[model samples]
Target: MEFTEYGFPPDYLDEISSAVQKNDIRDLIEEGLIKAKPIKGTSRARARKADAQRAKGRRKGQGSRREAPTRGTPRSTAG
Candidate 1:
């Protein structure tokens, strides 16, 4: 059977023969010939560094402030 008959494109192969049968494909997979690619983990280098700096109180300065400072109550003098 044509490999494309199963919805796979002509070039979408994982090192297996293009003219293989379904049972043959299963056999190859069972025998460790057809292996799936491993999933990649997200990198936390920058995030971990930021967390470490935050633990050391490095990012709490006024320059990094998010809110405006509150004002004290006003006082008035009467005549």
Candidate 2:
């Protein structure tokens, strides 16, 4: 049976296989096909750093400049 029969998104099959090969069972559990006991030793810091790097890479590839904040008349500070 295809993975989609088990309620998983079909497009994620390759990613799921790669995660299994890398010993990342947590990802499978998160996908909700089976219950998994929690495992220790995963690097949370490294995950955050990797995510930041990916975001930076995406922004660099897009090559779009961020718009500067607009300037307008200052509003009264009083409520």
Candidate number of the best lDDT:
1
Q: In order, what lDDT does every prediction score?
A: 0.63, 0.57
List where candidate 1 sits over 4 angstroms from the true fold: 1-15, 62-79
In the range 1-79, model 1's lDDT, one tens digit per residue, is 2335443335536646653788877876675555565566999999999989999989987777777454232445322
Which run of 10 residues does model 2 get worst, by summed lDDT? 64-73
lDDT per residue for candidate 2 within 2-77, as digits (tens), equals 3454455576667666774434766576656434344567679977987798788754432454443332325563
- Enumerate clash totals for all models, in the order shown: 0, 0
For model 1, which pairs clash? none
Best by TM-score: 1
- Report the error of model 1 at residue 48, Å: 1.0
Pairs with backbone N, CA or C atoms under 3 Å apart (clashes), candidate 2: none
